[model samples]
Target: MSEDFKKKFDDVLNKIKRELDSIAKRIDEYLEKGEIYRAYRIWRDAVLDSLKMLRNALNTLGEEFKDIKFSEDDLNNIAKYTREGIREIVDKLEEIGNRIRELRGRGYLWIWFDLKPIKDLFQEVAEEVNVTMDGVLSHVEKFISSLEKAFEDTGRRASQVVSVRIKEKDLELIDRLVEVGIFRSRSEAVAFFTRRGIESSKDWIEKALEHAKKIKELQEAIRREIGGEEGEEDKENQGKP
Candidate 1:
């Protein structure tokens, strides 16, 4: 990935980390207040939201990585690992939810004073989630590092290099485009847009010629009508004179 894209991806991961930290903090606050239900709700929502954000970040990173040509086996391994991680988190979340529901069904009111077993279960599950999240985060960082190294190695292997001068504003635009996954690099963006413009220019020319032809035909029809009317009028006048 380009520097701009890497920065954006890092921003996304940082936001997710902050959000997860906030959620964990809120869970602790609720638990301290003896509001077990509130804590549980917060935990559930946090897990769901975190998973969603992580998945989105992974997908975005995957798109960015596609720009770098990598081995199919490496790509497949990454995808498989990601899917397994998500699945494990989802399963754990579901298990926690089901345990909570079972306790609720058994007349457990979640009062802090007498709910030792439930509290223990909650803590256990929460710890597991924390561990899982940490693992996932670590794996993601490693994955990114590996990709970066691969990109560097690929660059080193390339035998040809081309340099071009670009205006500052155009460079900014290219960076934005790269950040948005429009192109892998400025060179790619330039090549793709140039090719598209060349291909579309031919189409545009053809359409313009078609329109010109239609206009010519219409003008000829109008001229014929006007000339025929004038000739008729002239003949009538000549006969009268």
Candidate 2:
């Protein structure tokens, strides 16, 4: 009976490992093709399924091994690490989603852009998650280390919300820009225009300053020329007197 239970436990662990490998491969392939959204969908679903399977397997293992010398505390710690690891991956996915929204708002459809860097980032995260999951099934200490390594690879960034009110005409213009493929969405259009406007304002200010400087130099030159002419006339008048 103990042998049978141990065989089943090993089988479950092997199955989890296989599934994790499959999922990681799929994610890598998709990301390599620059299909970020598709990769994200796969990642989200695979993580959820893997978590469910992992939890079930852990529960079954604990029940079967209760009579054995296995420490319940160790099992509980494993479960905790698994949950926390999944949470961390999910949080990273959410951050990516938010960034997508932000890009769309700025009139950037990254779909048409070179996304190798972004894809690489996703691949890195997916690989990390897979490695961490494997460690969770094998050793708790390694699992923690893997998770921390993944987090360090992907540093954290702060974000904030901004509100703006646009006129109907401006909104229409944004739509037209999107229609013309200048942007992927209204948000993207708005973001693009806002950035362009800022750049244009800076340029205008620079040009204005240059013109003002030229005007000042011209005025000084005119004053000097006029003063020289007046001095010459006064000399002529003095000589005649």
TM per candidate comes to 0.31, 0.31
Superposed model 2: Cα runs more than 4 Å off: 1-7, 67-241
lDDT of 1 by residue, 1-241 (tens): 2344345555765675667567667666654443444455565565546556765676666565555654434433343445444444444444444443343222232211122332232234334423333343445545434433443343333211211233445446545555544455544654554455434444654465566667778999999999999999999999994
What RMSD, rounded to one decimal, does every model reach? Answer: 25.4, 19.4
lDDT of each prediction vs. the true structure?
Answer: 0.49, 0.48
Error of 1 at 117 (Å): 27
Tally clashing residue pairs in candidate 2: 8
Instruction: After superposing candidate 1 on the true structure, give the runs of residues whose Cα lies further than 4 Å from its correct spot.
Output: 1-18, 84-241
RMSD from true fold, candidate 2: 19.4
lDDT of 2 at 79: 40
Show the colliding residue pairs in model 1: none
Instruction: Give the count of colliding residue pairs in each prediction.
Output: 0, 8
Per-residue lDDT over 38-124 for candidate 2, one digit per residue giving the tens place of the 0 to 100 score: 554565455446545646665565555555442334443444544454445445444443443343232221112122333343334
